[model samples]
Target: MKADVRLMVTADGSHTAINQTLDKTYHSVHGAFQESQRVYIELGLLAAFEKFPTEELCVFEMGFGTGLNALLTAREANSFQRKVIYTAIDANPMAVEDAKQLNFDDLLATDYLLKLHECPWNLPVEITPWFTLTKQESKLQDWQTNERFHLIYYDAFAPTAQPELWEPEIFTQLAHLLLPGGMLTTYCSKSYVQRNMRAAGLSVEKHPGPPHKRDILRALKMG
Candidate 1:
């Protein structure tokens, strides 16, 4: 979104985008690939499968900055023989055109990174037989969806970088959009953030985080 955007190599040899304007990066600098798989795919999506026991799931992703979570979720859904409807919203997807340069293809064994970005926004585009992605360039605060999500990938910038995004009022609004038994996963386990989720009427719990981080959060909406 700006001339100051740059691609960075993370610990797991995958790439992440840094926005100099916001002083924030899309993924964890510690290890983008590891962080993405653990926080979103392995933890978030799988939890939904356990709770829902369905072959199909709808996901609402807070940030589609790098499409790393989208890619991994697609892969996981394929492996699990499930259909994933991924709705990713990003206010301004930074370095998206340049995101093709990331080393994720080699790591993921799929060259669909550019395909993920080039797909038209505001419409569902089939990225694979098992995955359909719909990108929405809308801010989370202003986002309204008629569809409820079974899983939520809350991959926004850190609370410190964008405090408003982590506010309790925002989570309270998001809580109404979750299907019963749905859950949300995020790499942030800050006490305040957990409090926000709890305040929104979600059951919050702490889980082990990826490398270099102590804890992550998984909040569930019971049926």
Candidate 2:
């Protein structure tokens, strides 16, 4: 389960939200931006870019909490002159006004942050010439999409807090969303979660994680 009820700052001055219901934080306690950069950007996106080398890529993200992943991704797409079709799904998104209070002003442009939260759900909106975003207000189980993705950022809450989401069936569903050779990366490296990913037909690997986190999971679909 996810919570968008309260805002908190991580040790590195990045913003995160605490889910009182699940007793979890949206990002790593050590650093939110750092975690996103390592788990999703470095390992997930950049890795996929090498495997699927193209000027354009499609990405699907779970747990769009705070739009941190999307923001970082958009910046990369613009900076590198690449195109990104970013589709993010969040079951219960925090109110846009409340999200504005988070401490992302220094890391992101104010207008970009505002548009990220204010954009209409279910419709793809162009955030920049290179980045197009489609925010979906639906649960992973309930959401449907015809488009397959080259990268999937599996950034949901920890398996301990949301065990159901870390199940084999959930990973199997994610595998179906990926193109052959696509990868799913997360900051979680639990053995059970790796087993579930393998059971879902992904070849799993563990990579060094950012501060405080020891290992991250990266699972790939077969071509």
Best by TM-score: 1
The residue-by-residue lDDT of candidate 1 on 58-84, one tens digit each, is: 999998888899989888888888899
Tens digits of per-residue lDDT for model 2 on 148-213?
Answer: 999999988887877889899999999999988888999889889999999999999999999999
Scored by CA lDDT, what does every candidate get? 0.87, 0.87
Per-model clash counts, in order, read 0, 0
* Model 1 weakest lDDT span, ten residues long: 1-10
